[model samples]
Target chain A: MSSTRSGGRSAIVRARVLAAASDLVTTKGPQNVTIPEIAQRAGVAASSLYRRWGDVGALLLEMAAERLAQKFPLPDEGSIEGDLRCWTEKIVLGLNSTEEPIFFRILLAAGDVAPEKRIKALAPRREQLQAMLERGRARGERTPTVEDLVDHLLAPLYMRALVGLPVNEALAKHLVERLLNTPP
Target chain B: MSSTRSGGRSAIVRARVLAAASDLVTTKGPQNVTIPEIAQRAGVAASSLYRRWGDVGALLLEMAAERLAQKFPLPDEGSIEGDLRCWTEKIVLGLNSTEEPIFFRILLAAGDVAPEKRIKALAPRREQLQAMLERGRARGERTPTVEDLVDHLLAPLYMRALVGLPVNEALAKHLVERLLNTPP
Candidate 1:
């Protein structure tokens, strides 16, 4: 009973902190939101927040990962192109969201983000993408490698966002078409 | 004669500052090298650099643009694939240089980097790539649009770099292959 209560308390604190971060990022934009502000808004100790996230960038990254995955889970829509189009369109939408245009710059601005850090931040998304591709392969379809998807699909969308290009459903569909039609 | 002398003096100062910035960046890495150190090394006042580039990030961007273009001029190898492969391989090498992993993170970290600034930073290279594609069209080949090259070629390479993936000549060649073989 004691252990369960502590676990419940931990879960509440995490939810409150993430909620505070989302509110601040939506209002003030991402770069302006700081750890102290997040802590104060969450009603958690600033030290506790710092100990967990290390900095505003890491905290924002964690929030983005969780929120993006939860908000736009990729579907198994029976074809790689269909699933990819769905995923790509959702990612374009996600990038447009108030809070997710992202902390990528912040993370890199911190120090080019070590390989380990970059891997940690991307692993969740990569796993889901990989699973989607594995499903395509299991269906005996000629599936492009994850690297191809990164190069053709994800990279283009994210790079477009980074460079302030338009990211729309049509463009996302075009990227998926290119990914599928392109040869090995 | 007075104007001529001023022009000469300006050129000399510009060279000194760029050289100092490069040296400092090479020794200390891009993020760590500051305007003060660059100014001190070049024997110029910090005020002058501030007046020109506005920040370390801006200064570093100017340096990268000048150096990368100078050191790795893209060739017209008379075919889109050949030209792209040469360009891509050289870029892979360029990214491996002491200080060109780049100020992209720095610039973006400062802000999302206004589209105009991103355009200005990329304009010189874009012009060259455009010229190469026009040549491909003249030769009656099914040329990919400039946007396609950006999405398929440049975005992939830069994204891989951003993600801490290894960039090399073989991968560069592979990207060019994929870019050419893929239909619009």
Candidate 2:
């Protein structure tokens, strides 16, 4: 009955629900996805999901924010160029693969509850980018700001993918090259 | 019914429906707004709206696309720098306006029926950019590609606004400067 005693069980339920929600959103598309369906798939109570996340959009924001962190951990390649290049490529792949529009849709679809939640989703990635840039600076290399990365590297790929245009390693490589070569 | 008479009447219906959809989407969030509601607001039959648009997603795409064309006609300031800056500023305002999240949400939410529909939605905008760039090129103003404009100018503002970040004229001016200054 203790709150601490139930923490482990609570964590398991959270993971299962998020995984189910992610699977459904990517495979079936978010429009086709639902809370009852996610609860059924996760083997949890629909009431519990409602009580925790409140709605499908909230659940998706959490799931996507988590997936972004887990799936695209920053690459630790020695040089900043190498690090950013690897990270950007992995992101382009994720954005273009099974996750495609769903990942993008969830990120872009946040409403009034979203700015706060959306910040939670993107804040970590922003930190990761800043850390990478700092490493490059420490290595006697000048690095662009986080906003620069978002503008030149990540934003293009995401916007392209969101708009259903061609996006790939070639485009990713070009973006990184452009981002790095341009003077700060 | 002759196709010509129906064509003018059909044009009227489309204008009314899109205007109604845009108003509803901005006032009531996309999820809260529905095709039936759009039809009722437009003074059209729900069945007719369904027959024409097929679904809410399709309807939103068309409405947003038409709005894009009507609301944000490209500017002509006799120079690329002036034209692009003016145009980017206008877009930042629109994206940050009442449409805010909805303009972005609708654009980012397209799925299976989207690519062709999506291209139709964005292609005119692309051409307009190309024409602007060509004008600059004719004046020997050395311009960035349409891709550059998207990546540097449009994408960042869109991604930032889409993610609920602060986007304003200052930021839009910065993007235009970067896009124009970055060399080939």
Q: Pick the candidate with the highest DockQ.
A: 2
Docking class of 2: medium
TM-score of each: 0.67, 0.75
**Interface RMSDs of all predictions?**
2.4, 2.2
lDDT of 2 by residue, B1-184 (tens): 6999999999999999988988988888666678899999999999998898677877887777666666677888999989988988888777766645455677655554455557666666677778888999999888888877777887898877656678899988877877767776
- Which candidate ranks first by TM-score, i.e. highest? 2
Best by lDDT: 2
Clash pairs of candidate 1?
Answer: none
lDDT computed for candidate 2: 0.78
Q: Which stretches of candidate 1 lie over 4 Å from their true place?
A: A1-64, A76-78, A96-100, A135-142, B1-67, B96-100, B134-142
Q: What's the i-RMS for candidate 1 in angstroms?
A: 2.4
